[model samples]
Target: MSLTTDLAQAKSRANIRAKARAKSGSETTPAGEASPSPRSRRRKHRERIYQWLFLVPAVIYMALFFGYPVVKNIVMSFQDYTTATFFTGEAPWVGLANYAKVLSSSLFSTSLVNTALFTLGSIAGQFVIGLALAIFFQRKFPLNGILRSLLLLPWLLPLIVSSAVWRWILDKDSGALNRFLGGLHIVDTGIPWLTSTSLALIAVVGVNIWIGIPFNLTILYGGLQEIPDELYEAGSLDGATGWKAFRHITWPMLRPVVSVVLVLGVVYTLKVLDIILGLTNGGPANSTQTIATQSYDLSFHEFKFGEGAALGNVLVVISLVFAVLYLRASRRSVDE
Candidate 1:
C-alpha cells in the first residue's frame, strides 16, 4: 500500500514539472519568435547607428581632402586647364595630348634617368649608414641616447631650412666645407658642390641621404630591439657571433623591416621636390631636374597645368606600383 502511494506522488510531481516547464517556455518566448524584446532590439540598433556615426566624419574628411585632390588631378591631366581656366571657367578635354606632350619632351628621358640614379643612391647610402649607426647604438655607451636623439635634428627641421643650411655649407666660395677641405689640403680649392652640372645631382642626393638617415636609423633600431637575445645566444653556441650570426639570424629577421624601409625610401626619394628646388632649382642646364622638379616647373613656373598634371599622374602611378611592393613585403613579414 505504501509503495503504491509513493508511485502516485511521483506521477503527480512529474506532471507538475511538465506544466512548470510549459509555463516557463511560454513566458520566455512566444511561438516562432526568437528575437529579444522590442526595447532591447531598439537599443542594439541605436548602438549600431552610433558606431557608424563615429566613422562618418573620418570618411567625409578623407573624401574631401584626399579623394577630391586625386580626382581633380586626374581630371586636370585630361583637360587643358591653365591659369586662364579659373577666369574662363573652361577646361577643354584633350584626351592624351598632355601626356604625349610631356612624354615626348627631350627632358623626359633625362629626368627619368636622374630619378632612377637619385633614388638608388639615396636609398643605398641611407640604409647602409643608418644600419651601421643603429648597430653601433645598440651597444652600451655613454650618452648613446642623447647622441641618437641629436641625430634626428636633420629630419626634424623643415626641408627648406635643411636645404638652405646645406646650401651654405656646400657654397663654392668661403663655405665651411670648402674651408675645412682647404685646411686639410683635400681638394686644395673650394669645390663647386651645387653649381656644376655633373655635381649638382650628386650633391642633392647626398643631402637627401642625410635627411633620411635618422628615419632609417630609428626604424632599424626598433626592429633590432625586437630580435630575441636567446636566438643570438644559441647562434653564438654554433660559432655564429659577428658576421655569420648577423648573416644567418639578423638578416633573416630584419629583411621585412629592410624591405619596408627601402620601399618607403625609394618612394620618398622619388617624390623629392623641396630639397632639389631649394638647393639647385633644377639648374645647371636642368641636370638636377627630376620628374617632380620638372612637374613643379611646368605648373608653377611655366603655367603648363595640363602637362604638370600628366607628369604628376605618372608619379602617382609609380608610387602606386611601389605601394604594391610595400604591401607584399608587409604581408610576407606578417606571414613569416
Candidate 2:
C-alpha cells in the first residue's frame, strides 16, 4: 500500500510538469503570426532610423562641399572659362579643346614624368628609412622618447618653413652644405644645387623625402608597437631566429598597416606642391615643374583657366585610379 502511494505521487508530479511545459510552449507561440513582438520590431526600426539620422549631416556636407565643386570643376574644364569670364558670364563651350592642348604640350608631358619620378623616389626613400627607424626604436633604448620627439620636428614644422630651411642649406653659394663640404675637402668648389636644371629636381625630391620620413616613422612605429611580443617568444621556442622569425611572423602581422601607409604615402607624395614651390618654384628651365605647379602656371599666370582645369582633372583621375587599385589589392589580400 505504501509503494502504490509513492507511484501515485510520482505520476501526479510528472503530469504537472507536462502541463507546465505545454503552457510555456503555447505562450512562446503566436497563434497566427510568424514574427517577433511589435515592441521588438519597433526597436529595430528605431535603431535603423537613428543610424540614418547620424549619417544625414555628413551626406549633406559632402553634397554641398565636395560634390558641388567636383561638378563645377568638370563644367569649367569643358568651357572657355576664366576668372573674368566667370564674372562676365560670356564664356563659350570648347568641348575638349583644352584637353587636346594639354595632351599635346611638351611641358605637360615633362611635368607628368617629373611628378612620377619624384613620387616614386620619395616613397622608396621614406619607406626604407622609416622602417629601419621603426625597427631600431622598437628596442628599449636610452632617451627613446626624446629622440622620437625630436625626429618628428621635420614633419611638425610648417611645410613652407621646412622648405625655406632646406633651401638655405642647399643654396648654391654661401650655403652651409657647400661650406662644410669645402672644409672637409670633399669638393674644391660649391655645387650649384638649384641653378642647374638637372640638380633642381633632385634637390626638391631630397627635401620632400626628408619631410615625409618623420610621418612614415611615426605611423610604422605605432604599428610595430601593436604587435604582440608573444609571437617572437613562440618563434624563439621553435628555434626560429632573426630573419626567419620576422619573415614568418612580423611581416604577416604588419602587412595591412604597411599597405595602408604605402597607399597614403603615394597619394600624399603625388599631390605635393608646397615643397616644390618653396624650393624650386619649378624654375631652372622648368625642369622641376610638376602637375600642381603646371596647373597654377596655366590658370593664374597664363590665364588659360580651361586648360588648367583639364590638367587638374587629369590629376584627380590618376589619384582616384591609384586609390581604387590600392583598395582592391587590400581587399584581395584580406580575402586570400
Candidate 3:
C-alpha cells in the first residue's frame, strides 16, 4: 500500500512538470512561432563581436594618430605655447588672444587672399588640363601606356626637388625658361619670375597645376573606364555622338567624379606649404605668403606656437566646411 502511494505521488509530480513546460512554451514562443536556439543566439553574438573586432585596429589607429594630434593642436591654440613653454613646461591659457593677434595682422589678409587665388587657379588649371588628357587617353593609341607613365614623373618627384628645378628654370639669369623665350623672341630680357611680386604667385600656381595634373588624370581616367561602352554605343545609335554624347551622357555620369576631384584639389591646394616655401619662401614682400606658410613661419621662425596653432585650426575649419558641404551635396544628389 505504501509503495502504491509513492508511485501515485511520482506520477503527479511528472504531470506538474509537463504542464509547466507546456505553459512556458506557449508563453515564450506562442503558436506558429519558433524560438531561436541557444546555439544560434550565441553564434549571432559571436558574429557581431567578430565584425567589431575587424574595426578595432582602425579605431585604435585613428585615436592614437589623428585624434590625439587634433585635440593637442586645439588645446595649444588657446595657450601661449612657445619655446619658453618647452623649457618651463608651462603653456598659459590666453583665451582668444592668439586668434586676435593673427587675424588683426596685415599679413593675414594678404595670406588669405593669396591662399584663395592659389587654390582656385591651381584647381581650375589642373582639372581642365587633366580632364582633357584623360579624355584623350581614353582612345586606344600606340605608346599610350608609355606616355601615361611618363606623365606621372612630375607628380612622383618630391615637391622640394620639383620646386628647385622650377626655380632654376625660372631664374632671372641663365634660366631655361628665359632662354627659351629669348630664342623664340617672346621677350627681350630675362623675366624675374620669382623675384617680381606680380609674377611669383603665378609661377607657383603653374607648378602646382603641373604636379596635380597627373593625379587628376589618373582618377578621372579610372572613372571614365568604369562607364559602360554599351551606353555610348546605344547613344551613338540615337545620334548622340561627340559633343552631344558628352553633354547628355558623359557629363552627367562624370559629375560625381568631377565634384570629388575639385573638392580634393581645393583642400590640398589650401595647405600647400612645401611648394611655396621651396619656390618663393613667401618672399617678394610676402606676396606668396599663404596661411600654411604663415603658420610655419609663426611656429618655427618666430617661435610663436600659439598663433601658428590658431592659423592651423582656421585651415582645418575651412577644410571641414568644404567636406561638410560636399557630404550634403552628395546626399541631396543621391536623394534626387
Candidate 4:
C-alpha cells in the first residue's frame, strides 16, 4: 500500500514538471518542433524582400512605359489634343466627339475594308508558302543549309529598304518584273503594277508576303523539328506516308505553333504602316490606305491628334478582341 502511494505521487510530480515546461515554451509550436529563432525569421524575411526587389525594376519599367503610354493615349483620345495643346499644355475635353468623327468618317469604312483584306491576304499567303517551304527544307539535300540561310535575307532587311526595292521592282516602265515579262513577250505594254488603284494593294500585299515568309518559315520549322521522329516511324509501319503522314501526324503536333504564328501574323499585319507608307504612301486614290496609315495621316498630316488617337484605339480594340478570342479558343481546346 505504501509503495503504490509513492508511485502515484511520483507520476503527479512528473506531470507537474511537463506542464511547467510547456507553459515556458511557445504554445502554438508543434510538440517536437522548436520555435523558430529570431535570426532565422529575419533571414527568411530578408529572402522574401530580395525576391520582391528583383521584381521592382520590371514593375517600374512596365508602369512607366506601357501603362503610362496606354493611359495617355486613352486620355488623349477623349480630348482635343493637338499641336496647340502641346504648346499650351491644355487639352480641352471633347468627350466622344473625336470618336464620333472618326467612326462616322467615310474614310474609316474604306480603311477598315482595306485593313481586313490586307491582313487576310498577307496571313494566308505567308502561312501557306511558309509552311510549304518549311516542309520542303525538312529533307536532306546538298546546299540545303546555304539555301535556307539565304531565304532569311528578306526578313533581315529593313522594312523601308524592302519597300524601296520592291517599289523599283514593280515600276511600270523599267522594273525588273516588267522587264522580265517584256523579254518573254507576255504583254505588249508594261503593266501599271503600282500606279493603278486596282493593282497597288495587290503589289503591296505581295511585298508584305515576301517579307513575312521567312519569319513564318523559321517558327514553323522549329515546330516541325520539335515533333518526335518516332511518331513518324511508327506511322510509316502502319502504312502512313506522304500526305497521309502529314495529315495524321505532322499537323496535330504543329497546331500549337501554328496558332502562335497566325495570331502574331494577324496582330503584326494589322498595324503595318512603314511598308505601305514606303511602297505606295497610301496613294493611288487611297486604295491601299489601311487604318494604320489613316491614323498616321490624321495625326501628323492633318494635325488632328485626338482623331488619330481615337482611330488608333479602334485598332487596339480590334487587336484585343482577336487576342481574347484566341485565349478563349485555346482554353476550350485545352478543356476538350
Q: Using TM-score, give the best candidate's number.
A: 3
Candidate 2 stretches with Cα past 4 Å from truth are 1-34, 330-336
Q: Which runs of model 4 end up more than 4 angstroms from their true locations?
A: 1-47, 327-336
Tens digits of lDDT, candidate 1, 274-302: 99999999888988999999999999999
Candidate 3 lDDT by residue in tens digits, 67-179: 99999999999999989899998999999999999999999999999999999999999999999999999999999999999999998999989999999999988989999
TM-score of each: 0.85, 0.87, 0.88, 0.85
lDDT of 2 at 282: 94
Candidate 2, residues 8-31: lDDT per residue as tens digits? 555566567678758867886766
Which consecutive 10 residues in model 2 have the weakest lDDT in total?
A: 1-10
RMSD of 2: 14.5
Cα lDDT for residue 309, model 4? 97
**Root mean square deviation (Cα) for candidate 1:** 15.3
Listed per candidate, the RMSD to the true structure in angstroms reads: 15.3, 14.5, 14.5, 15.1
lDDT of 4: 0.91
Could you arrange the candidates by lDDT from highest to lowest? Answer: 4, 3, 1, 2
Each model's lDDT comes to: 0.90, 0.86, 0.90, 0.91
Mind giving the per-residue lDDT tens digits that candidate 4 earns over 188-304? 799999999999999999999999999999999999999999999999999999999999999999998898889889999999999999999998999999999999999999999
Sorted on TM-score, best first, the list reads 3, 2, 4, 1
